[model samples]
Target: MAERDEQSGAAPGALPRRAIALLRRLARRLRPRSVRARATLGASAVVALALGVASFGLLGLLENNLTRNAQADAERQAVLTAGLAAEGRLDTVLTPDRGIDFLQVVDAHGRVLAASPNLRGRPALSAARPSEPGTVRGTWNGRPVREEHRQRVVQVTVATGSGLVTVYAGTSLREADAADEFIRASLIFAVPLLVLTVALVTWRVTGWALRPVEAIRAEVAEISDRDLHRRVPVPGSQDEIARLAATMNTTLDRLEASVIRQRQFIADASHELRSPITVLRTQLEVAQAHPDPDLWGELVNGALEDTVRLQDLASDLLLLARLDTAQTPPSAAVDLTEVVREVARARKGDRVAVDTEIAPGVTVRGSALWLARIVTNLLDNAQRHADRSVLLALRVDEAHGTAVLEVRDDGPGIPPADRERVFERFTRLDDARSRDQGGSGLGLAIARDIATHLGGSLTVQDSERGAHLVARLPLDAT
Candidate 1:
């Protein structure tokens, strides 16, 4: 079971799995879905978090500073009272300062010696009895005091003639507390408003940033097969958005070219098919009208010829379609030498004397059937034009990493100007449309397309008297 679990990639440890799952769910819930939402929320979240931290830190610093200042003031007053007692004017402490809320002097026995105006003759402000004379202050020092009508007080002790005296001082905390409360309330009110303002600003900015993309999307969506010539708007900024628009236009250009070629192919195929159909129909109609027994065999043979032509034309069309849309890489190892020899053997015993000089080990990577078709097409093309002899050659150019094949014939060679044009579909040299030529005219075109699809090339080369065609394919290095 452990091995199976491991093989299936299950988690290996007992852990806080439920907690982890819950956290993942919460994370997913908090995540914004759209680009615009994510941008706005991310910006707002960062700003809100910063404001919260800064507000907390600033409020804490202010409170600490205010409390320390109040404590320092009380200690200063206590020291001043001790100085007055040393000069025999300790009673002067009864008149407290303006900010002072309370002041009192008590003896070692906890008896009041001097008191502020409002606390005259009151009991000792502190509940703890004072330490004995010459006692070191520790826990024995006066404890914190709280009066019924005032906040807590700070006290200090001083040595006097009456043994040891304690001075108690306190000030109202209302002003400091009020300032803190005001700051807290202000932050509480302003933070949400700031966050809302940030969210609004971020949302608007994100929309503005995506406006060009939206325009491009709308333009692209409007485009279809009917109007592939139209292009998306390109921004003038020369930024990434502009690059995207340019790339999209480039893609549209390719799509338009493909559509045009497809339309031309369909038109050409339809026209070619109609010719045989019309001829077959005419021949059958004439035979039916005449009803002659002797000419029936001739009419049937003619119909069979037309049917064969139609079959060949349809097969060529299907092959072209497959070539256009084929995505599989050609990895079959093919020997060009063998393919050429095979074509030569098949085309022997004809009027054209076929010769071969096939070198050994001229190997390439491609479909064997297509490779054989290429050789067969070339031989057939040569046979049609050759007056006496055709030469077939296959050799390996190891230095160039290529396998080369050539077909040459002693016939009225293709003119330099019409060499490239002959490879077009349905093209023929005989402008008179002679049936004696006997070809669908897609042989060389299909051969060239197959060579190109196999990462190779087929081209017409300059010949002195006969047409020379050369096909080159990348040699299989392995």
Candidate 2:
């Protein structure tokens, strides 16, 4: 068989050895690359370290126990030999039934009087003081004992013709050393295999634990802003991974809603601008065809109206954009009462009966310009719709820590369903209402946005006789 293996170039166990090497290569290639790999490596290293330390400690303890047992047996036999020799029956103690390697009766001068069959006439096994009694190595019957061999001795006061003699009885360590070596060899193979088994188990457990996280990462990676409607898969496990996936889905939902609102805002702004642009173009075309001074005057006046409307719409759009991005309003105190008074005094209400109920010194923290715009929008909205009268009231509600402004007009009160919708951008209840009278549908929207930006709110209130609007703001300290 040896000759055939040499000829074929296939050593014993060569096929299995090659298979193991191939498996090792494949395991290395399939090793984890992400956090899972790191976890597996870390866990496996810890387990291997713990198991190795424990195995080494246990093996050392086993060796010590075996050696101690051997030494104890030798000591007991030595004591028995001393008792036998003291009674002058030393010959009966050297029987084949005795379990020891060598037995000797030596005089004080170190001469062997009686010995085991194998060392009948040899010198004493040991003469000098033992370094570690019962565990030292020495020669026996012209043969050298190994360092691992165990031995024990005792002094016996044996009766003799002239005086007393000391005898040494001991056992060999052949059996104990054999058992220890076997265990040591077994552990040398077993510890590494045990460590490898622990590592494999740790790797598998770590992979199972991180599977959900990897799935979430892959799913999230495929989502983009344009496809925000897509949601990540939530794991059924009630763990951090499940919560993370749920939070991600919720964030996507908000982003989708924001995108939809943004698209709507852009579409409305374009439509509003196109109206004025079309009207201006028509007037210019007519002026160009007429070329008369009186007609030119009318055309220019009409164009100017359209231009003013365009400028106002542009300004409102810009303001809304700024409010959208602003974190806080300007921190300046403005008197709501004074703001309302200024608007009431500047109005040219020749037909509408403007009634004012201004409470003194109602102050709030915000930009003066934005405050004035809020008051103006409320008053203008009322003036446009009121048939005969518009009531404006301002008061500081000391109990509520807020300043309030109320504007009511005796016009068609808004329906309960449309109250909330009226504050949306570019919303108009009556399409037939001329642009000059309705102004822009953005007035209420801009008013509400400014109020909200300044840490206040504008809302419609129930009114039996007219459309009522209320604005509230946090009051500056007294």
Per-residue CA lDDT of candidate 2, range 64-176, in tens?
Answer: 67656655665566667756665667672265235666566665566666776766656765565322213232223324323345543333445555345665655665665
Writing each residue's lDDT as its tens digit, candidate 1 over 32-138 gives 89899999989999999999999989888886677667666666676677567645688733877767767888777888888888787568766676564222211
Clash statistics: count for each candidate: 0, 0
TM for every model, in the order presented, reads 0.70, 0.67
Clashes of 1: 0
Question: On a 0 to 100 scale, what is the lDDT of residue 125 in model 2?
Answer: 57
Residue runs of model 2 more than 4 Å from their true location after superposition? 1-33, 56-227, 326-364, 395-401, 431-433, 475-478
Off by over 4 Å in 1: 1-38, 60-186, 291-293, 410-420, 429-435, 462-465
RMSD of 1: 9.1
